[model samples]
Target: MFYAVIPAGGSGTRLWPLSRAGHPKFLHTLTGTSASLLQATVDRLGALADPASTYVVTGVAHVASVARQLPTLPDANILVEPSPRDSCAAIGLAAAIISLREPSALMGSFAADHLVRDTDAFVEAVRAAMGGAEAGLLMTVGITPTHPETGYGYLRCGDAVGDGPVSRVAEFTEKPPYDVAVSYVESGRYFWNASMFIWRVDVFLGELSRQQPELYAGLMRIAQAWDGPERERVLGEVWCTLPKISVDYAVMEGAAAAGLVGTVPGDFGWNDVGDFNTLGDILERDERGNVVIEAGDGPVSKPQVELLDSERTVVVPRSGRLVSAVGVHDLIIVDTPDALLVCPRNRAQDVKKLVDGLKERGTSYI
Candidate 1:
């Protein structure tokens, strides 16, 4: 059985106001569909895994909302962290728990805020990765790069493994400069690291134990108490003590060095939706290349929205007020009841700076 673990613990500061601490980016519907990103993630996994087998590891504060969003998944499957520890701890904990449940289980960890336009291709890539996982290899689903993207890390793939599409990971490169990224894309051997992985529970845990023993030990201790009376107590005691690192740094990087990592190249239209610009690109655009997220609920008339001579602009109105834009190009305007943001599309990634400023000013706005 392939169990899916979703790590849903990001503040999404880059998508502030709309994505708040109480309700992060994954909870919103960036896609045209009404279902939220988290819900859509679970929906996509349903093709391969049972709802009961799916687990979501999120922060304690967001537990209630996560549960509310995914009622089909059992409450016990919603693992709650006492505090934020990066992906290593979150995914390791899920691996440890799955290791206890079905010692022979296969599992995959996917982020909660990704957008996939091609569901069939996504599922096929995951199924292909499972073949690599069965052979005791750490498998990552790498996206075939469509452009030279500097925002995401790149993976160097070597010769194909066996007869399958899986390739041996040559190296894991960090996000590079524009020139370097372009060269990588031109080589055609590099892929965008989508952070999607699949491997047998035991295989993953063994590598994790060898590479990140302290973190593995902490997770094992918590898992030992997971179904017992000491579940919360042990988790509270050991979780925060684990090293704060990402799974890429803690396990994947080392596993790649040891020649134990493989990647199945994917071309299933994937987007992380990290900021307003990315979100704008994913949303449906008008003839003038404008994406308008309409305001108001039910059949009630929406507020007046005028976009005159606007091109490639994103307008979101939630303040129940008219939003008029004229001669604006490649701008992002998000208005909520309490907060309003106006920024250029190129500066989308820096929206987090505004949140940091909000923190310095006061926590109330945030």
Candidate 2:
């Protein structure tokens, strides 16, 4: 059986004010759906994997909120990390735990806050990736590049693997300069690295051991105590010691070098929703191209947003008070009870700077 693992660990600082440390972006309903992004991720996983077998690796602070959001997930399946240790550790822990239970189970790791417009295409891509996974190769879903996107990493694919659409990964490239990114798109061999990987738990753990032996050893030790009374104690002692690295750096890159990595191309309207501008792209806009997202599900009343002569603007009002914009063009306005963020839509990625500036101001502001 295929098990889906969602590493729910990012704070999404680029989406700040609306997305806070206490309440991250994945917990918000950014897609205008009744369910939050975390719930949406689980719901998407239900297309291939059973909810009972699905797992979410999130931080200690968000455990209660995650459990509250996904009531159907067993408490045991919600693996709580004492602190944020990045994607590799979060996914590695889940892999180790699943290995102990089902050694040969296939697992797919997907982010919690991404938006996939076409679920059928996503499932088809995942099924294709599973072919590579069953063959014991580290499989990743690569999005067909719609444009020369300098912000995302690129995967240079080689030949097809075993008569399938899946291809052998030639090289994994970091986010390139704009000129180089344009060349990558023109070449057509490059695909955006979505970080959606599928592989057998045993195969993944084996690769982890081959690439990052220390981390693998640490995870195995913790997994040994996972079902026992010493689970908390062992996890607390070992988890923090893990190297703060991404799975791309710690394993996938090395595995690609060793010719064990493969990728399946996918183009189903995927958006990472990293910043307000990208979020605006997926959201419904008015005739003048203004997108307004009202606060919902909170104890507070719906926030009233009034726009006057605003064009191509994105307004997120969470403060319950009426937010009125006058003569603003191509701007992003996000209001919370404690903070207000106003910047040009082009500068949406810099929202993290405001979040960082809050650190010097006070914890209450953050």
Candidate 3:
């Protein structure tokens, strides 16, 4: 059986003002649709399996919002993490739960906020990755790089496996420099590390036991308390004690070193949707290259606007607000109810540093 575990806990500080502590980026309807990123992610997985087969691992803070967004999902399927323990623990917990129910089930770990255009191709890629996992290989879907993107990690692929399109992962590089990324794309030897992994429950658990014995022991303790009323209590204890590490650092890297590697080429037009610039790139931009997202109850009035010499810019006006731009070029103007972010287009990625500064100053307005 094929099961999906979506790790929905993420602090999307980069998309601030629109993404806040109470409402994270996954809950934002950046596409101007009624569905949120988390909801869309769940809907995408529903095409591959039943709602019962899909599980959401998230923080306790967002449980209510998640439940409200996805009413079809069962309440029990929502595994609330007591605290943030990073991806390794989140995935390990999901694997442990699936192992208890279906020993032979193949689990796919997905980030809840990624954007993909083609659901059909995503399903196909998942099937290919699952096939490798069923054959006792730790499988990951690597996207064919469209450009020399230094923002994302790259996976060096080895020879083809049998007649399938899947390839053995030669090595994993974490966010290489510009020249190296360009070389990787030019040589046709690397793919963008999408972080989408597929593996059998027992296979991942065995690897965890072999590589991270301490974390495995802690997971075992939490798994043993699954049937008791002390489940949440035990999980809280484990959350505080387990080391904070990503699954790539803890298991996949080690498994690759141990010669158990598999990969599937993912050409599903995937993007992390990390920030507003990426969101603008993904969405349908206006003639002026602007992407606007409006939400909540607000007055709508069209104001006469005239642009003198604005070129190559994106202007997003919040719902119920009148915005008029004049004589602006190569700027991202994001006007929200609480905060307004105006920055050069080239420095859009660095907005996260501004958010970090706000966080350091303990300013909740951001």
Query: Where is the poorest 10-residue window by lDDT in model 2?
Result: 294-303
Report the CA-based lDDT of candidate 3 relative to the real structure. Answer: 0.82
Collision count for each candidate, in order:
0, 0, 0
Across 301-343, the per-residue lDDT of candidate 2 in tens digits comes to 4438889998999988877789898999999998889888899
C-alpha lDDT score of every prediction, in listed order = 0.89, 0.89, 0.82
- Candidate 3 lowest-lDDT run of ten: 296-305
TM-scores for all predictions: 0.96, 0.96, 0.94
Taking all chains together, the TM-score of candidate 3 against the true structure is 0.94
Model 3 Cα lDDT, one tens digit per residue, 289-318: 655555522434564233446766666676
In model 3, what are the clashing residue pairs, if there are any? none
Measured by TM-score, how close is model 2 to the native structure? Answer: 0.96
**Superposition error at 130 for model 3 (Å):** 1.2
Candidate 1 residue pairs that clash: none
